[model samples]
Target: MSDYCGGCRYDPKQRVGDHACPYTAGYWSFLARNETEFSGNHRMRQPMQGLHRLTDLDALVDQEKARGSIAP
Candidate 1:
């Protein structure tokens, strides 16, 4: 999953994107769902570091908001 050089559309390296991997999907959901309770821990900070690299962060947040509206 580390390599994006293959034909796989999803990139496990990214935090959020159309080509983001399953880990990102779950990670984003966890973060969004627990935004208030989430803290700046070393473990969380490690993976979240890459989130700053995403150019379309707004779009990713929008996607989370939309998902929240549809969720029960």
Candidate 2:
């Protein structure tokens, strides 16, 4: 089952699976394309912040590991 648009499926013939997964490249492209107006949007703001904070994934992972968040 596809997870596009709140777990709803779109037409496979017209759209690709990339549009289904929220983490897909196409999804980010969609978000980037629609970012300007979403500044005031509730959900978008936090993720935008997360996107900014996640720029250093490796360091975040290392920090989490240091904090015993990851299983060895």
Tell me, by TM-score, which candidate is best. Answer: 1
lDDT per residue as tens, model 1, 1-72: 565547867786764666766556556655655544555676667546555565766666666556563253
**1-72 per-residue lDDT for model 2 (tens digits):** 964555445442321232322233333444444567777899789766654553444443444345453543
Worst 10 residues of 2 by lDDT: 13-22
Error of 2 at 37 (Å): 1.3
- Give the TM-scores of the predictions, in the order they appear: 0.43, 0.36
Q: For candidate 1, give the lDDT of residue 61.
A: 62
Model 2 stretches astray by more than 4 angstroms: 1-23, 53-72
